[model samples]
Target: MEENKNKVVELLKQYMSTPENEPSRGISYLKEAVFILNGQGKTLAAHEILEKELRKFHDNSTVEMAILLNMMIKLSALVGDFAGAVEYSRRAQAICEAKNERELLTKVIINTSGLYFKMKDYDKALMHANKALQMAKRNGDEINAACCLNNIAIIHENGETGESGIPYLEEAVKIKEKHGMNAELPSSYVNLAELYYESERKAEAAELLEKARTIAKANENEYAIVEAMKYEARFLKGEGDLASAINLLEEVREYHQENGNKTELLGVLNDISSVYELMGDSKEALNTFKQITELSRSIFKEEQARSIAQLESSFEAREKLREINDLAEQNKRLRTVNEEISEKNNELQEMKAKLEEINRLLEKQAETDPLTGLLNHRKMKSVLDSEISRAERYETPLTMIMLDLDDFKSINDCYGHLKGDELLAAIGKLIRSSIRKNDFAFRYGGEEFLILLPSADMQRTTEVYSRLKESLREHLEIAVSFSAGAKQWKGESSDEFISIVDKLLYEAKAKGKDRLETSEAAI
Candidate 1:
C-alpha cells in the first residue's frame, strides 16, 4: 500500500507539471487518483493527495479538467463533505454550461439536486430536480428523468399531507418500469407506497411494498434492502404492531451499528426508542435512548478529535518545514521542538478520550396510567391507529372492549373517592396482566377503560373479559363487578369500532350493571 501510494503521488506530480492539454495526461492522473487511492475508507488521506495534485494544475477548458472536477464532486459527497461537493459541482457546471453540453449539465444538475436534498433545502432541491427532469424529458433521457422524478417526490415528501408528491412517484415508477430500471425501481416503489399509505390506500401500498422486497432481494442490493426494510418497519409501526416493528428496526439498527455508520444508527435508534415509548414500554425506550446518547457523544468526540488532530498536524508540518530550513543555523533546537510537540499530542489524546466519556443522559418516561402503570388515553389512541391498519392488512379479527365501573359515582359516595380510585387502579393492573403481549390495555379517563385485542374472535374476547371480571371479584377485599361491552372488527374504522363498543357498554349499565354485553356485527 505504501509503495502504491508513493507511485501514484509521483505519477500525479509528473502529470501536474505538464501542460493542461497534454493528450490524456490530466485525465489519466484523475483516473489514477480514483482507481488507486479511491477514497472509500481513508477519504481524508485521498482528498488531501487529490487536492494537492489538483492545485498544481492551472484552470483550463479541457475535457480533462472537467472530468477531474466531476470526480471530486462525487468523492466529496461520498465522504459527507457537502460544501466541497457544491463547490466542485459549481466548477463543473460552469464548464458544462459554457460548452452547451446539455447531457452533462443535466447529470450535474441532478447531482446538485441530490446534494441539496441531503442538505435538507427542499425548495432548492425541488428547483434543481424540476430543471433536471425537464431537460431529461426534453432530451429523451429516461434514466435521469426517472431519477429526477424520484427526487421531486422525495422533496415533496417534506409536506404534511404528502398528497402532492404522489404524481411524481407514480410518474417515476412508470418511467422506471418502461426502461426496465430494476436497480432503481425498488426505491420508486417504496416511495410511491409511502405516499399511497398517506392517502389511506393500504392494499396498493402493500402490493408495492411486496414488489420492492422481492426485487431488492433478487438484486441483492444491500442499500435497497435496508431502505425497503425501513419503510416496511414504518408501515408495521403504523399498523399497531410495535413489537414486530421494533424487531425489524433492530435489524437495520444492527446493520448500521456493525458498519460504524453512526448517522443511520442514530436515526434507527431514535425510531426504536420512540416506538418503545409509544408502546408504553418505558424501560426499553430509556435503554434505546441511552444507546443513542452514547453514540451521539462518540460521534461528537470523533469530530472534535479530527479538529484537534488537524490543528496539531498543521503545527507539526510547519515545524518540520522550519527545522529543515534552519538546519544550517541549529540542530540542537530540533530535539526540544519535537519533545514539546509530543507532550502536546499526549494532552490532545487525553482530551479526546475525555470527550468520549461525556454523554447526554436523555431518559424518556412513558406516559401511562400513573396509578396502575398501564397505557394512558393518548398512547392507547396511537395504538388504535396502528392496530386498525394491521387488522386491515392481515384481515385479522380485532375486538375493542370498553369497560366502565358500575355506578362509579355511587361507589365513590359509598366508599369515598379514594377507595374508588384504588379499585380503578386495581382493575387496570388486572387488565394489564390478563391481556396478551399484543393486546393494549388503557385507562380511558375517569372510571372507563378500554382494551384492544387483535387476531381474536368475539367468543374468545368475551371469555377473556369474563375471566378478568372473575379474577377481579376473587382478588378484591370488597365485592366488585364491572360492566363491559366488546365489538368485533368487521371492516370498520377505529372510531366506528370504539363508538359501537361504547354504546354497548352504556346498554350494559342501563340493564342494571355487573354484566357483560357484546355488540353483534349485524348491528
Candidate 2:
C-alpha cells in the first residue's frame, strides 16, 4: 500500500511540475490524482488537495475550474461532506450558466442532481435530473440521457414507496437497449431487477438478471458480469433454490479468482457460505466463513489497486474515443474541400463548352460568304473538282449549268448597293434550293452562279434552269430573268467545262434575255 501511494505521489509531482498548455491537460492529470486518492479511501484528502489546486487557477479558465469543482463535489459527497459538495456544485453551476456552456451544464446538472439526492433534497434532485434529461435530449446525447434517467430512478429508489423507481429505471434501460449501449446495460438492468425482486416478481427478476449476464458476457464486461451473477444468486436463494444459488455463487467465485478480482471473490465466498448455512451444512459454512475473514484485511488494499486499474482502463477507452472523434472531424473538412473542387470543375466545364461553341461559329463564318450565306468561290471550287473526279472514275453522266441575271450590272447602277446585295442574296438562296440533292452550287463571281449536277443529262440540266427562273420571278416580284447555259460533260476538266458553260451563257444573253443555250449533246 505504501509503495502504491508513493507511485501515485510521484505521478502527481510529475503532473504538477510539467508546464501546462491547455487547461484540460492539467484537469486530466489531476483526475488521475483524484481517482487514486478516492480508491485509497482518502476522499477527504483528495477533496482538500483538489480544492487547493483548483483555486490557484485564474478566473479565465472557467471550463477547467467548473470541471475540477464538479469532481470535488463527487469526492466531498463520498466522504460524507454533503455541505461542501453542495457548495462546490453551486459554484460549478454558476460558472457553466455564465458561459452558456450547455453541454458542460448538462454534466453539472447531473452531478448537482446526485449531490441533491445525497443531501436528501428530492425536489432539487428531481428538478436538476429532469433539466439534465431535457438538455441531453436536445443535444442528442443518448448516453447522458440514460444517465439522467438513472439519476431520476435513484432519487425515487431512496423513497419509502414500493415501486416508484421502476418506471424511470425501465426508461433508462430502454434507451440503452435501443441505442446498443452495452456499457450501461448491466447496471440499469440490475436496478430494475432489484425492484422486481422486492415486489416478488421472481420470474421477471431472474429474466432481467439473465439478460444482464448474457449481455455482459457478450461485451466482455467482467465487472458487469460479476454484478449480475451476484444479484441472480440472491434472487434464486429468495425463491428457495439454495443448491442452484450456491452453484451459481461458486461459478462467480471461480470467475473472480481467475480474473484477479479478489474483492468480488470475497463477496462471492460469503454468499456461498450463507447458502451453505441455509442448507444446514454447518461444517462447510464455517470453513467458508473462515476463508472470508482471512481475505477481508487484504481486500481494502486490493480493492484500491483494482479500482486504479479500472480507472486506467476507462481512461484508455476515452482516449481512443477522442482520437476517433478527431478523425471524423478531419473527414468532414476533407469532404467539404472535395465538394468545392467539384463545383469549380463544373464551372470550368461550362466555360469550356461556351468557348467551343464560339469557335464553331467562327469556323463557319470563315467558310461562307457574309453577304449571301453561300459557299464562296474558294470552297465550292473544291466541290466542283471532287465531283468532276467522281464522274470520270465511275463513268457517270454529269452536267454543268451557269446562270447570270440579265442586265444585272445596269440594275445595280440604277439601285443602291444594299438593294444589289439583297438581290444577290436572293439569287444565292434560289440556286441552292433549285439544284438536285447530289448537286453542288457556287457563287462563282460577281453575278454568275455555277451548279455541278451529278448523273444529269442536258434535259435534266434544262429542267433545273427553268425551275430557277420561275422561282426568281415568284419570290423576287421583279422582271429579272436568267440567261442560262447548260452543257453535258464530254471528257472536259472542271476549268474547261466552266469556261465552255460561261461562253454559252454570254451567247444566250446576246441572243436575247430569258433564253437557254445547250450543246449538241442536249439536242
Candidate 3:
C-alpha cells in the first residue's frame, strides 16, 4: 500500500512537471491527475484537485477548456449528476458558439449528444448531432462529420430503422475520402458494415469490416486498431466463428487496459460479458453483466444526483417561459375582447401565428431523421404500419426485403477505413438507386437495410430483389452481395412476419452466405 501510494504520487509529479517543459501541458496534467487519483480510490481528492484547477483557469485555454469540460462532464456523469454534466456541457457549447469556434463547437455538441443519448432522449441527441454535423460541413471538417455520422447512425440503429441512418454515414465517408483523413475511417467503416450486416447483407458487411481492420493496422492508431479488432470479433460472431470472436475481444480488453484507456476498458468489460453470453456460459455472463451494471451505476449515480440541482435550475427557466407565454395569450384574449386595438391585435395575432409555426417546425424536426432529411424510424414505422393495413384491406400485395453487405470488412482492412467508408457511401447510393418512386429503404440496424414495397406480390418482390442485387453488384464494382429475406405478409402479426423473414435471412447466411431467401405464409 505504501509502495502503491508512492508510485501514484510520483506519477502525479511527473505528469505535473510536464508543464514546466511545455506550458500547454498543465491542463493535460491536471486532467490526468484527476483520472489517476480517481483510479487510486481517491475520489474526494480527485474532485478537489479538479475543482481547484478548473477555478484557476476559468477554462480560458482552448485545449485546457475542452479537457476540463470533458473531465467535469465525465466526473459529474459518473457521480449521477447528469443535470450538472448537461449544464456544463451546455456552457461549453455556448462558449464555443459565442466564440465561433467551429472545431470546439463540434466537440461540445458531441459531448452534449452523448449525454442526451444516455438519458434515452434520442430526439435531443439527434438535435445536437445535427448541429455538430452542420458545423462540420460548414467548416469542411471531415473527421468531425464522420464522428457525427457514426453517432447518428447508432441512434437510428437503436430507434427502429438503421437504413435511414445509412445515407448520412455514407455521405460522411465521402467527405472523409475527399479530405484524405484516414484516422477516423475505421470506426465509420465498422458502423456502415454493421448496418449492412443487420440488413442481412452479410457478405457486403464482412467485406467492409475487413477493410476497417486493415486500415487501422496500417495507420497504426493503436486505439483505433484495437477498436477494429473488437469489430472484427463482432463480425466473426455473426459469421459463427464464436471462438475467434471471444479470443479477439479478450485480446482487445487486455490491450485497452494495458494502455490505460479506462473508458474503453469499461467497454471491453461489457463486451466480454456479451461474448460470454454468446458462448452460453450463463454463469460467467451473469457475473460479467453484474460487473458492468455496477460499473455503470458507479459512474453515473453521483452525476445523476448532482444533475438534480441543474435540473431544478432548468425547470425554473422553463416555468419562466411558461409564464411569459401565458401572459402573451392573455393579452391576445383581451385584445380579441376589445375592438379599438385593431393594428395591435393584428401584430399580436401574427406573433401567435409565428409561435404556432415554430411548434409545427419542432414537431417535424422530432419525427424526421436530421442527417438524411428523411422520415425517422418512428415516423417510417407508423407509415409502414398504416401501409400494411391499407394493403391488407385492399387484398393487394406488400413485401419487405432485408438487404445486407458481403465481405465489406476487407475494404476497411485493405485500402484503409476512409476508402472503406467511400465504398459504403457508394453502396448506399446504389441501394437508393434501386428503389422506385413508390419504394422505401431504411437503415434497419448496423449494416442491415430494409426495403418496403407496397402493392407488390411475391413474384414482384423476387424480381425487384434480383434487379437490386444486380444493380448493386454492377454499380458498386465490388464483390458486393446482399443476403436478403423477402416476405409478403399474410394474416400474421407484423412482428411475427418480420421475424420469419429475419430468420430466413439467417438461413440464407447458412446456405451460402450471399444469397436471398423468401418465405410466405403456408396458408
- Candidate 1 lDDT tens digits, 162-232: 12466678888998898899988988998889877744577999999999989988876665777788889
**1-523 in candidate 2: lDDT tens per residue?**
5765787788688668767666666677777777666544455567668867765563544677787887877765544455556767878888888989888889888888887776577888988999999999999988789989998887766742222466688889989999888877887898789877754456898789888988888866656777787788888886789988888888877766654444457768988998899799999999999988877756445435645654565657789768767787668878688779999999999999999999989877776777777767787667777767767876767788888888887787888777988889988888887774346677777887878777677777777888888888888844688887879888887788888888888888878868888854332
Using all chains and alpha carbons, the TM-scores for the candidates as numbered come to 0.50, 0.41, 0.52
Task: Judging by TM-score, tell me the better candidate of 2 and 3.
Answer: 3
lDDT of each: 0.75, 0.76, 0.69
How big is the positional error of residue 61 in model 2, measured in Å on the Cα after superposition? 4.1
Choose 2 or 3, whichever is better by lDDT: 2
Q: Is candidate 1 or candidate 3 better by lDDT?
A: 1
- Cα displacement (angstroms), candidate 1, residue 114, comes to 2.0
Per-residue alpha-carbon lDDT of model 3 for 62-179, expressed as tens digits? 6556656766665544334466667678667666667677797787787777667766678888888889889888987778877788779777656543234666677777877777
Best by lDDT: 2
Candidate 1 segments whose C-alpha is farther than 4 A from its true place: 1-79, 159-163, 257-263, 290-523
Shift of residue 149 alpha carbon in model 1, Å: 1.4
Candidates 1 and 2 compared: the better one by TM-score is 1
lDDT of prediction 3: 0.69
TM-score of 2: 0.41
Best by TM-score: 3
